[model samples]
Target: MDSGQGCVGLSGRRNRCRVTDSASVAVSGRPREAWIDVAKGVAITLVVLYHAVMYLDGVGLAGAMAPLNPLLDTFRMPLFFFMSGILAATAIRLPYWQLFRKRMSLLLYLYAVWVAAQTLFLLALPPISPDGPNASWTNLVTLFIRPSSNLWFIYALPIFLTVAWLTRRWNPLIPVAVTGVLAVLFGSQILHTDTPWDKMGRYLVFFLAAIWLGPRVRRMVPHIRWWHMAVVCGVYLGIVLIMVKLSLTRVPFVLLFVSILAVLVGVSVAVVVARAPGFDFLRVLGTQTLPIYLVHTFPMTALAAVLMATGVSLPTVAATALPVLLCSFAIMFALAAYRRLAAVPGIFTVPVASWVDTSAVAQRAEQAEASA
Candidate 1:
């Protein structure tokens, strides 16, 4: 099915296009690409850094890092959800029922499992508050209903996915128009309510923008010059710095727009990095993002807790943030390794029997045999 300029075609027999192929062809299956993974890598690392800072603040060092936190907030999770929307485009090509079941179910499983893990981890630790809430049964239940922290992304994604699916047939401008209205409402504080709409209002725009404009974004990549990206990055950094200096931290709509710009900058950087001479590490990090996302929070929080418990001095907090970030990466690496080891054999690796076009594999095999 072609929706104006955008074509929706069956991604694969798996009911969704592989992430690598989502942007390559007119819905026809194609080999996967690496730039998106690089983008995802950048987004996930920013998330870890954001959490690290949050952990530092929880340990009473927020005052020291307050200058930098606002700038970080501009891009952190906006890049994340934007990338998610890009990734979601792959499944959006699938039949409605299949798309809903696959994407929603996968997210639901991951969210449920991690939420349970988080609960258990807190129970084992001393009583503490990460974001101004006391540890109690009511708070715990509240988390499931409306997540109060980083976990809210998981809670909100399913809803966004559903909205995108239902509104798939509507004019793309509809979402954009709705997003503009919501931005106005949110910026003016017209509702005088604390509903999740406040939070949802901020991100739904980016999410829909990503889904609706993903193809156009992908097509522009090849034409973007190095200087164009450099200029965008410079402007974005300047805006962020000015916002921090002016102490304009309360404007959600402004931040939301900045976040969209950040996505553009991030995606541009990813494209350049993917085509550059080196930086395999970013690609590796990106591929392992799922495990990183799941495990980074705990160690980051635990590190801050330990520091606070020992009554660490303030000056040391700046130095401590880097270590906390490293520890989070280490924890994620360990979990990823464990997951790889525990996966069923065929599930962990590409199946040798499933390749209908085996010329590339056969050629590689012959080369290996000759080398041997």
Candidate 2:
């Protein structure tokens, strides 16, 4: 999503905050709005939890965990996409070359690096899929067409950024309508694929909407009343109950509506949590989400394997909770060591100085001054 930049408060009416720090401000570098980090913190935590449950269930480690809460599956990724969209507003104003290099190129680098890393891990470990493809250069090419397994999130960002840039100058409604159509197409599976593009079609609209709304949303978040949350929860439960009662297959349109509602609900929940004081842990967790997201897969898979090997079985709640907690702590220690080594946290961000257009910056500065 957005790099480690300063963010305005998501509560109360405030001018958008200026972002000047080059390093990530999400966790520690410089102080910034607490709520943005909190929201991100909350979203990333849910993501880890979601993955934990899924992994445990896959391996039959969850003894009593009951199947994943159907409700959580509805909104987990949407929360992330929505937050990324909010952060994307900043990019629409950047010069095109800067936009491509700073925003788009970074995602490409991360996706490529991690895709290779994942392939190596999979090949060496050789999970249940004994017939999985061998690690080779050809798998790199497949990244452009395939989802790259767990790293699909990284693969999708460049596509979102590029499209957002092209439509930066258009009437906001134009992109809104276009992305909306894309969302419906994705929901209907009319544009179905096993790749991240399948998700891109679903989430691109939220990203574009954040850019269109921009600072307006910061003020709106505080206005989410208790009744709003109540309504959101009510609707979600009603839908789930009705679906169960009917025993009908999930329709595309129904999924689309629920997803949209779930996103709104997630935003509301984040705002509520943000307004509450004394939760610095979430902000810290938020800052490290990138690194954690990258490194966590290892621990999750390893933990599952270890349990399976030891013949240790945990109840569903313990199965899911243990992995999430352990993975989070494991990633944190790994990150701490990495930082101590003075490593550039490429997992969070990487600059592409080679893509610099030195003259372009000068020309833009002069043009702005001349206009002024």
Candidate 3:
């Protein structure tokens, strides 16, 4: 994902707003559109809810909401990575060293910090059996070399970015074809290994597709009519619900294209909504997504533990879902508030000096002088 710096210059205003405005223009010739933010907000909330429900159900306090959960899974991560790709498209214009320092460095730092935090938490807590075998020291070492788990996205992103940079000049179709082949191989279970490269190979399809298709997607915004968007959403919902009813196991492959369609639908919906009046909640939630992503797990985990301790059986699907949703939003709101306060000078903002070149700024200034 692009760093906050990539969103704007060292202007007094926040960069995120600038980036969002730019993205809106790319979509519908407007600045500061609201609905794209809403789509992102909704996607992140779905992720938090999915994790929360799974954790609660894992402890036997709740039964599976498999039907609804499966449907929700179709678009959650896809929307996220797509949004990241959209943001990263802007960052790609920066010099390589600046891009590495700003984007890749932050991802690495977060991955290391979070992995260490998870390891320490696991060690200090009771030795509950994991869903799979206890990850061996060898496996953990390997994970560092090439990450697994949800954290793998962050680990794999730099590689995707590098490939994107290298292949930037090639026909975008070439990378799309290559990534498709890789996805098929991985999805079919042919490319089996614990190696990071193997793991990267699996996810690179979606990541690269995001990069390759970003510009095309941006250009398509104008042609997307409201009725067309509605039809797409209807079809997407129908397909997902049908798959869920059929108890589809390997649905990702089928849903991959659907997910791409959903992103377009999402962008279309955002453009339409953003043009309309008043929906500040979505913009607020969207702005807070990164913090929510980082911290929502803690509250969700705590809520699960509390429900279990109270002997509350979330036997009904609704019971299982409501707490999870509530806790996730609560955590998001709390984190948003914290980030707002932390934005104060010398409080929580880390002050690393970036080595980004301002040649664009110089060029613009020189052009203005010449014109005068």
Candidate 4:
């Protein structure tokens, strides 16, 4: 959900590595990687676009964006998580409790706060669209149990990071093997699980793959020449077309392979735009993805409500146009909220007092760490 790095350097940690303000960076004094931010920019745009399509559908404006839903679905979230894993790969090696205290605490806090915020927004405005985030207040009770909200990604973050941390001590290949199996099971429809859980299972391998391969990918993204992008793009397009023609994307094992390739193709795209001049806006959007992720839906929901009330039917081309429009509006609105409220202690960040004791908690944490 965020482009900011996770956790921090700890003296007694598993790997004395530092996660930084940049998504992935040269804390040893290298410039912040623009490619990472660019990739996230691409991902977050797709994310907002997807949401806009869903929210607008009930109002009879499923627009040109509707057709892209399946193609983009393959790698959107997976790319997002892979980028996250790249940034947090170092932090994932922190001793379990330290990792929990720093990364999990913040993720959990943000998750809880945003869940409540979404509930309040829906309660006051009451979305008119049936396909909106959540319809019933009863769904609130299952926030943790079933994760019946748009913010399920936030909920899944802490859980996924924990899994990564828990397996940090094991042979790296082991967790990937296990998660790969789970992804195949859920992805191929062999496992009939509920929505969020099913998605969580399906994406677990991508994150771990990032953790395992992040450094190499980061190293490789810079040297990626235009011809490389052309080659991969051709291959990706061919494979996708073949899949669509034969419906091999739905085949059992092929689904996972195609999804993996989709993520790579996504990475390949950043190579073209990353270092190119005039793409700084995309980089900015990437850095600010956390705010956008948390708050973008507010504006989309309002769009849904407005469309429903006005009896205005958007043009079919709006599917292509509406999502970009919504993405622009939503990103601005969220960024404004983030900046204006950032100074207020408890708004943009988790209020330390809410979860941590300033007095004795550190001592207790030390003791707990030592004993455990």
Model 3, range 119-192, lDDT digits (tens) per residue?
Answer: 55444443232364323445445556757564666667676777777777788789878887776565445675
Cα lDDT tens digits for candidate 4, 228-305: 888877887788777777877546767678778878887888868887888878877877777688889998887778
Residues 267-356, candidate 2: write the lDDT tens digits.
Answer: 666666666667777766666566566666666666655655566666656765765576466567546744553234343334333532
Candidate 4: clashing pairs of residues: 63-319, 64-319, 65-319
Q: Rate the local accuracy (lDDT) of all candidates.
A: 0.58, 0.60, 0.55, 0.70
Best by TM-score: 4
**Candidate 4, run of 10 with poorest lDDT:** 8-17
Worst 10 residues of 2 by lDDT: 8-17
Instruction: Order the candidate numbers by TM-score, best to worst.
Output: 4, 2, 1, 3
Residue-pair clashes per prediction, in order, are 0, 5, 0, 3
For model 1, residues 259-297, the per-residue Cα lDDT tens digits are 768887888888888787586667656655655666677
Q: Supply candidate 4's per-residue lDDT for 299.
A: 87
Candidate 2 residue-wise lDDT at 76: 65
Question: Which parts of model 3 are misplaced by more than 4 Å?
Answer: 1-35, 62-64, 126-143, 146-148, 192-203, 245-253, 276-278, 306-311, 315-318, 333-337, 340-372
